[model samples]
Target: MIDSSANSPIVRLVGVEKKLGRQKVLKGVNLEVRAGENMVIIGRSGGGKSVLLKHILGLMQPDAGEVWFRDQNLVKLSEEQLVPLRKETGMLFQNGALFDSLTVGENVAFPLRERGNVNDAEIRSEVTRALKIVDLPNQEHKWPSELSGGMRKRVALARAAIARPALMLYDEPTSGLDPVVSDSINKLMVRLGEELNMTSVIVTHDMVSAREVGDRIAMLYEGKIYIVGEPRDVIESQDPIVHRFVNGISDASDAIF
Candidate 1:
């Protein structure tokens, strides 16, 4: 396990800017995720959380500024050059994003197969190990259609971790689930990070999950990060926008024309 206490950032975004179509989504955003820490990003519905996530993944280059994964600057890397770096990262999409046609085991082994050269036995072994971590062992043969929402999510998580990447990115891992199930997912995320010793950047709107899983919380408002601090600090912030968001209050009428 890497020493998470190290001050150096595993991921850093420096003055990142992006404009999607005509909308300026990210405006000079800057943030960092230290090694092996779980950094949860919370924001309003259109606060550029996903856009920022894309920059980290090297999926979308910032129109200005830099995205750095350790010493390498992602902004300078071409798609081919970025492939090796991307191999060290795993992403769990909002909806699980599993292939409906594939069985659970196949889904988990997808990354391995794409990388090629591994024998079928090794792939199956890795899949079983990952499934056990997610607490869904012996579920290899089931189709995604046969599993409940929670089970499907576990499968997605297993798939994400099968490669044993150094970093994990989760987009709304608790979305579309019951409160109890959402809490369970939150716990699983924490367990995975601890057991695998992987750094995580979770983009979520679920305050409960954010508080429970995050080592630090970053709140994005408008087009910039309004605040970044410990979950308790972020929750107890006296700032009006932060207060309104944390308490789920809206003063939209105040902005009425």
Candidate 2:
């Protein structure tokens, strides 16, 4: 379905296919993430979740089909064209992806520094502001090794928002965290999108995170979007893939390959 308005489609993937060597990571994937809306994509591991996020962020180019961001078809953009787009898109990696060599302040300031023209004092101020937004105001001086897993994720989150991205893409935001920590991450995901007026797309397996953060949820199954709707509707959707996935029934496509 075509959404005529540019604002209606912040991210769109049409018949997109990606392959890493001989392995096909995405097969005819069709998806959309609307502006200022939070969409959580849920599926089994290796089900093309992160692959989709990477395409949207310009971190990865698809082997076939189109990946569109706003009015630009991402597949057509060169690395230089993608640079300005990077400033509008932020990604939070699964492992928090912090630089072990840098302190929290430096990590958060890295993006702005890469853009140049800003002095150290200005970068420091922005870093502090980002940290405060994530509720870790004074941890800027600490190294990533010095923080707990949840804290590290928060620091990474601060870094992601440091540049004020128009689109925020998350790869398994609550992965490798305790239930308490996961809940905190979930809250932050929701808060960032709602409180900051951002369009977000999060790839996650945590059902709790899906329910907590998604304004709408999409189920990626066997290289296609099996279902998309409100979180409750998706869970209640009786399509085999949706039912099996929602019920945690593996060995059921026994899901078709």
Candidate 3:
């Protein structure tokens, strides 16, 4: 029972390639993320997970290959042309990436403010609603330094979703939290995806978080997607590389190594 829009993927990377300095970070990587689905990308450090996300965000263009959003080939579009597309997408960085000087409410309203059409009161109302969705009701006056790690992350997530973006990209959403906090973040992601009706792409190495939030998991290795499957399928995979990853084994002979 896949989404009817599944036939039209929201994001598709066709043989994407990128090189940074002396290393080829993405070597003909290919993937398709369907609309209204939570697609998680998992890999070791330096395996090009973030790089791939950057490509989708139009922060980077592949040296060769096409990156498509809906029907548009993003690589062919100029930066000016990509602005509307970027606005329709939201990104949660590894860090909260909030402006230290901005209050939580202001942080959530940043995007709306940038658009310059919404009045102050409307921005305030949207900010309050987004904050409430993240379960941080009436905490708009708090500063980033005053909030806990989990709260800061939730604020960041609220900011990302404030625009009601059609696509949401999360980078290592649970990177620096305790187990209980991590689970909370995981549940929040699932809930947001359901309630907002937005397609989500998460980049992380945390298997538990991936299992909890992902509808389909893609494993990046050697700058390419080595495998893509459901969480249970990934866990039970016979592929040595997947097995090694699931079991947290390090070996020279691993395919992903």
- RMSD to the true structure for each prediction, in A, is 2.2, 3.1, 2.5
List runs of model 3 lying over 4 Å from the truth: 1-3, 252-257
lDDT for predicted candidate 1 compared with the true structure: 0.92
Give lDDT tens digits, candidate 2, residues 11-93: 98999888987888888888888898889999888888888888888888888889998899988999999999888998898
Pitting candidate 1 against candidate 2, the one with the higher TM-score is 1
Clashing pairs in 2: none
lDDT of 3 by residue, 1-257 (tens): 86577546999999999999999999999999999899999998888999999999999999999999999999999989999999999999888799999899889999999988899999989998999999999999999889999999999999999999999999999998988999998999988988889999999888999999999999999989999999899978999999988779888765663
- Name the lDDT of candidate 2: 0.87
- Model 1 vs. true fold: TM: 0.96
lDDT (tens digit, per residue) of candidate 1 on 26-45: 99998999998999999988
TM-scores for all candidates: the values are 0.96, 0.93, 0.96
TM-score of 2: 0.93
Q: What local lDDT does model 3 show for residue 53?
A: 94
- Per-residue lDDT value at 237 in model 3: 94
C-alpha lDDT score of every prediction, in listed order: 0.92, 0.87, 0.93
